[model samples]
Target: HSSMGEVWDEEMSSSMLGSRLRKVVQNYQAMNKYNVENTGPGGVASRPKLSGSELLCRLKSQVQVLTLTPDLQPFASLSWSSQLPVKSVTSELGPYKSCAVVSSAGSLRNSGLGKEIDSHDAVLRFNTAPTSGYEKDVGSKTTIRLINSQVMASDEHRFLSSSLYSNGVLVGWDPAPFSANLSQASWYNRTDYPIFTQYQRYRRLHPLQPFYILHPRFEWQLWQQIQDNMVEPIQKNPPSSGMLGTVVMMSLCEVVHVYEFLPSRRKTELCHYYQRFYDAACTLGAYHPLLYEKNLVKRMNQGTDQEIFTHGRVTLPGFSALNC
Candidate 1:
C-alpha cells in the first residue's frame, strides 16, 4: 500500500522532528550543490543554459505539438465498450486567453493569492489537493484538474464519487518507459499504472465530464527537453505534474501565470497547503525531476525573481505565441 508511515515517523517529538529536518535539508542542499559543481567548469556556464528566447523556441519546436489527451482510436483495442469516445479537452475549454497553473506547494500558504489565482481565464490544480477550506490560499475555481494514474487507480472511490472532480475538466496521466514510442499497444503494456479500465469506468459513470488520459509521449518529450536544457543532468524520472500542467496551459493559452511551482519567499517544508506534513523532497523532488524543472521555469520566467519571492508567481508567454 502507498503509505507515508515510514517516511513520516509520527512518534518523533515535534522538537526532534524540527532538529532532524534541518539535517535533512542540509544534506539535500549539499547533494544538490555537489551535483551542480561537479558537472563542469564554472557551474551553469559549463552546460549551455537556454536563454528565454532559446527556451521558448525549443518549447515551441519540441513540446507544443504533443497533446495531453490521447486520440480516439486508442480505446478500440481495450475490451471496454463505449458508444462514444472520450471527448477532447480542447473542444470543451479551447483557446483560453490567459490561464493559471496553481501548484500545491506549502509556500502558497498565506500568500493571499486566491483572488489573483481565480482571476485567470482557466486555473489548473494537481491531484487530490482540495480547495474547500483553503479557499483563501487556493482559489475555489478549478477549470482543469490534472492527476496521475495513482489517483485514478488507488483512489477510485473518491475519483468517481467526489463532486470536486465532477465540476472541472479532468486529465490524468501514467508514465511509460522513458524511450517508449507512442502507440496504444505499447502504452497499455508499459505504463506503471494501467488506467484504461478505470478511465473507462469513470467515463461511463460521468458521460458529461470531460476526462482524458494525457498521452505518455507528451510527458517524455518534456522530460527530454528538461534534460537537454538543464545545466546539470537530471534524474531519468518524468517531470512533475506541476511542470506538465504548466506546459499544458502554455500550449493552450496566451499567457500562463504559474503559482508556487518554484518556491518563493514564503517557502516551507510543508508538502501541500492543505496538510501540515512537511517534506523537503516535495520541493527538491525524490521521484520526479523537480529541481531541474524549477531551474527551467526560472530560466523561462519573464517576471523578476523578487516578484517570484514575494508573490510566488511566475508569468510566462504561452507556447502558441512563441516565434519558432
Candidate 2:
C-alpha cells in the first residue's frame, strides 16, 4: 500500500535478522539462566518447573521480575471479571531498555497456560502497575485454558467448543456447520494454537470405531486492556522533525513493539514511515490485533500521519472495544 505518496516495498525481517535482536533459540547459545523466585503474598501461578529457592539463586547480571504468588491459595484462579493486579514493580537494576520481560515460571512444557496468563498479567498489570521500565510484556497472549481434571495428559488439552453457556463452557466448536459463533477479529482455538487440530485431523484418518477423546475443563479468562490499545503510540508526535516518528505499545501478549516514524513531510516522508511501520509490523510478524489494524493512517501534521486507535478483530460482550 502507498502512504504519503511513497511506496513501501520492504518485507518483514526474518529470523535471520531477528535472531540478533532476541537471545536466539535460547539453547543454541548458552542459556542465560536466572534465579528462581518464590511467589509473593496472594494467589499465584504454580512454578512446578522452577524451584523457588533455586529461582532466587540464578540471577546473572540482574533481572527483576514481578511474580504473583497465592497469598492464601496455591494456584491463582483468575475468573472472567478479575482484572490484573500489580503494584510497585519498577525499581530494578537500572532504567529499562527494549526487551520482553518473561515470567519467572515460564516452562516450555506448559507453554499454553503458563506464559499465556503471565502475558495477560503483563498487559493488565502494566496498564495499572507497571513493574519494569519500557514496555515489558506486550508480546504476551492474553488468554489461557484451565484444567481441573485428572484425565490423560493430552486429555487436559483445551479446545474451543462450538457453543457455550454464560459461564463460558464449551458446548461445541465448528462453523456451527451452519453459522459461525466466532468472528475473524480474534484467533480462537481451532487449527493453530495449542496443537489440537493436528491430532484431530490425523485421528479421523483411521477411526471408524469409538475413539478415545480427551476433554478439557474450565473456562478461559480474557485479559483486560485499554479500549484503544491497538492504536499505536506516536513517539515524537509532531513539532520535531526527522526520522524519529514512532509508534510503540505493549501488546496483551507482553511483546514490545516499535513502528518507526512515517515521515509525511511530503507525501514521500509520510509514505516512508508508513511502510517502515507497516513493513516493520510485517517484518516483526505482528499479525495480532495490535499492529494488525487496517490502513489507519491519518494526517496529524505535514510530515506525520497518525493512526488513531481503531477497531480490532475480536470483541467480547461487555468490552466491545477491547481488541484481540
Candidate 3:
C-alpha cells in the first residue's frame, strides 16, 4: 500500500524528475525556435505528410525516386512499431529536394555536446570527443540548442537556461534517426508547463498551420489545395457548438499581424512573447507538438498544480548555417 508519506526507494526520484524536466524545457525551446525559423512560404519543410484518404489520392498522383546510395535506411528504421512493419511518421512524406544528408560529424558533435553540459563528466568526455570542426565541410553548418546542464543544490532554482547557437544559426538537436523512444518520447505532452496560456490562445484561434505560414510564391496553387483540403477543414471548424470550451480564440487580426509582420527572411521571432510561451512549455513537460493541441482545450482549460522544467541554452561548437 502507498501512503501520503514517502516510501523509500533507492532511486533518486526527485533528482530524476528535475533532470527530465530540464530535458523537456530544452527541447521545447529549440523546437519553438525552429518553428519561428523553418516555417514560412518557400522554406525548408517536412515532406508532404498528407493524412487519411487524401494520402491515398496523393500516393496515386505522383511517383518520384530518391536514391538510397550512401545508406540511411538502417538508421531510418529506428522507430518501427510492433504492429506496423514499415516505419511511418504521421507527417514525414518525403522526396523533397533540400534534405541534407548529414554525416557522422553532426552525430559526433551531438555526443560531445552531452559531455560539455555535464560538469562532473565534462573533463572526462572532453578528452575523448575531439572538437574536429573540419572533419569534412560540406560548406558551413550550424546547430542551435538550449542547454541546461549544471550541478546545483536543491535550494537553487532557475527558470531560464542558456540558448545555444553556434557559428551563426540556432543548432538543431542532431537527433539519431532511429533513437526515438528516449527522452524525446518521454515528455509527450504533459501540461506541467506554465506556457498553457499561449497554447490555450492557439487552440482557441486554431490557425490552419502550427504558426500560420506565408504562402510560397512557386507553390501557391498547390499550397492552397493542401491548405483548403487538409488544413482549413480542421483548423477553421468553429469549436463544436456545445458548452463554451475552456479554450478561447486569440484575436485573428492580432495573430495575422503577428505572423505577417515577420521579416522577409521568414526566420524572425514568431511571437511577441515567444520566449515566455516556450519558457512555460519547458517548465512543464510539453514535449510533443500535441501539448499545444486544441483537442485538449477542454482538459487544460482548468489549471493543475503541475511541475515545470527550466529553460537551458548551450552553444555547441563546430557548425554554422549559411543564412542564419
Candidate of highest lDDT: 1
Q: Is candidate 1 or candidate 2 better by lDDT?
A: 1
**lDDT by candidate, in order shown:** 0.72, 0.20, 0.20
- After best superposition, candidate 2 residue 49: deviation in angstroms? 45
Candidate 1 residue-wise lDDT, 253-318, digit = tens: 999999988777778889999888988778767567676687778778888766776778888998
Which segments of candidate 1 are over 4 A away from where they belong?
A: 1-47, 65-74, 79-92, 182-185
Candidate 3 per-residue lDDT, tens place, 1-324, comes to 422322112111112345655565345534432112212322123445334334323322321111111123332443321112122211222121121211111212222223322221111110011223432322123221111112111113221221111122110011111211223232212212322233234324433212111111211222222222322111111111110000001100111000111011111222211121223222122332221122222111121111100111111111011111
* lDDT by residue (tens digit), candidate 2, 62-105: 21222222221211342311111222112211121222222121
What TM-score should be assigned to candidate 1?
A: 0.81
Which pairs clash in the backbone of model 1?
Answer: none
Q: What residue runs in model 3 are displaced by over 4 Å at the alpha carbon?
A: 1-53, 56-215, 218-222, 230-274, 277-324
Tell me the RMSD of model 3 versus the true structure: 23.3
* Residue 143 alpha-carbon offset, candidate 2, angstroms: 27
